[model samples]
Target: NDFPLVLQVGEEVVSLGRIACPIILTTLLIHSRSIVSTLFLSHLGDVELAGGSLALGFYNITGVSVMKGLSAGMDPICGQAFGAKRWAVLSQTYQKMLCLLLLASTLLICLLWLNLEPIFLRHALGAGQPTRAQWTSVIGISLAFGYAILACVFTNFLGEAWGKLYTQDPDVVKLISIGLPIVGLCELGNAPQTAACGVLSGTARPKEGARINLFAFYLVGFPVAILLTFQLKMGYRGLWLGLFSAQVACVSMMLYTLLKTDWKHQAKRAEELTAAVGERDDLEDGLINDSNDER
Candidate 1:
């Protein structure tokens, strides 16, 4: 009874768990920088907060979207090579994708870093605080989003009860202080959750991602947010708390999945897949060369 016994688990269970864990960790590492920046800006006062929010929004739309989109095409290639055990191709693909992202980030910095003032002004002009009545109606609509950006915007609105867009009210600042940190926590969690999904896709396990998303966000997160925000009268903090809980849950679940993965098998499969892809490319190149020689 005192002896430690090792029980052999099924391969599928192991594979799913191990694959899922790194994805969650990788995602969190990648996304935490932005959320941390937002958290810092939230402490700086209303103008800085709003300007920072606008900058983040612009970065997501222009820079982040482009980078994710371009890099996404490589997922299947990596996944297939991984699954096929093509090690060399997998390594090359991984390196090439990294290079591509670096290039993209450089280009984006050149474009966005130089034009931030204009972007902030454009967003600031459209920014306004709604009354409590308006907010009640707005929250209903905003609850659908994973990150309720409007909640951040309206944290300042708590001070603008008279319907003014800008305010120097201490009450609003007090409310903002309470809500913004929660926003930071929620956003920080989003990184790992999104990275887990990306990893799942790269492993050709999108259904696992779908399942995790449904259970984590809908079953656990959504109810908690509803309960905290509406039932507890916790307001924006409650909603963000719910989001933080969801991210934690998602990370936990994904971690469990990744811990179970058969990495040796995955490596073998990657090597096989990479070799097949390389041969196909060689054949295509040869055919093109032959036609050019004939011409």
Candidate 2:
């Protein structure tokens, strides 16, 4: 009964208070970390803090736009398969979506990591700016993302499954499983790719649903992404520590979920449902559309 449920409700008021709720929440989440980083920067002097804030604002706008667009693509495919009860289609779509997102993340990591110095230099060069120190921070963030990013693909996977199982198809369950040790081992690798809690929450199978993505992107990931490019404590290393820890926590939860569930019956039901739907559509065959394909 506990899960990320999609709400469908009738329209209500669009009052100023209502309108401002999301906006206020969003701004705070966005600014919090960089605010902390900026506090650190300001102690270094005025110029650094101003540069940190400015560079961060610009990066947030660009990254949020892209992340939302991708969410649209993911939402529709999963929604339709789920509403229509098409398990095989859902599985196949996941495969394609994953491959595409992997390439996209790789490109995103490369572009930001490589251009961060130039990006900050352009904005940080203003008068009274903490130019060199801020530049160092920006460069650091860029390098931190270079680790192999498994990211949170499982979060989305689980979120979709949550809807199907806990809701209309309580009988539906996912067959795919990920072990805790392997998930942890992956986190420790040299590449320092995206880890458990955060990635799983944001990408693979977000339990709090897209809020995980929304929060991680705007709040957690955004500042982390920016700070890596903004400071020099351990250079790139210090910047990524918060984010790495977030993902590790998320991954552990997902792996644990896998071990505790016994819903093979759910998946079996979903599979049967797909076949039943196909049969009811009344093609030329009963259950065997392809004689050679029968299992």
Candidate 3:
């Protein structure tokens, strides 16, 4: 008998939530560390606060973001392996990921140590399934819109007073009030794109996600930011607006790709990826030969 559609969807939501909630909480907790640090820095004076904030941002962009992105590639492989009960594959993949991350960390450290000039600039899940792509897409789009609305609400609610939470300096508060809302709006694009990327990874198609990000951020977003910041004199606000533009492009392209996806083909690909070999092959051969002799 086929499972009821409503029940199936409900199950999917629960499953997704099971995986997502812990991650969300962990992310919030991790970020709170930075917030706590900033609060302490604020007590030390503006220059100290500014330098500390810059260092934290720099570390996030160069170190944490890179590691997270690299680690994400494992989602598909490991998820498929687990689903297919390929314990060896899952174990090996985990080990390899550790090695890769260690090497990457080493390289990043060297690069950062060698060059401090670029510090002035820049900034920066899984796929698998019981064919969870559709539900995942819905959740992603919902989050995109939800975050956008929240951004607007909070921005309005806080109004000019929002900046006072961090500092009493009128100039600093003014800068925060102007820039924070744009940064919040950026989540409208960032949220959905992040979810869509997970779907791609689940389907073992991380390269496409990578390409989309490169095109969105570097090819499109960075240029727009430079133009608005330097040419339009919008300053840091322009920089964030540029980020918003990139995020919009990213979510648009990500949704387009996900909408166009062939889920059945992805399932078949997952099966192929998890197919057994070696000892399993030999064991199956022996069983078939014995059955033939009995026949």
lDDT of each: 0.52, 0.38, 0.67
Regions more than 4 Å wrong, model 2? 1-31, 110-295
Q: Where in model 3 is the C-alpha error above 4 Å? A: 1-4, 99-132, 277-295
List the candidate 1 regions with Cα displacement exceeding 4 Å. Answer: 1-52, 75-169, 180-207, 277-295
Best TM-score goes to which candidate? 3
Candidates' TM-scores? 0.45, 0.28, 0.78
Every model's Cα RMSD, please?
17.2, 25.1, 10.2
List model 2 lDDT by residue over 116-176, tens digit each: 0012211221111232313322232233333223323333345444333222323222211
Ranking of models by TM-score = 3, 1, 2
In the range 21-120, model 3's lDDT, one tens digit per residue, is: 7767877898999998998888788899899999998998888888877777566666666666667777776777778887898888723211111000
lDDT of 1 at 214: 86
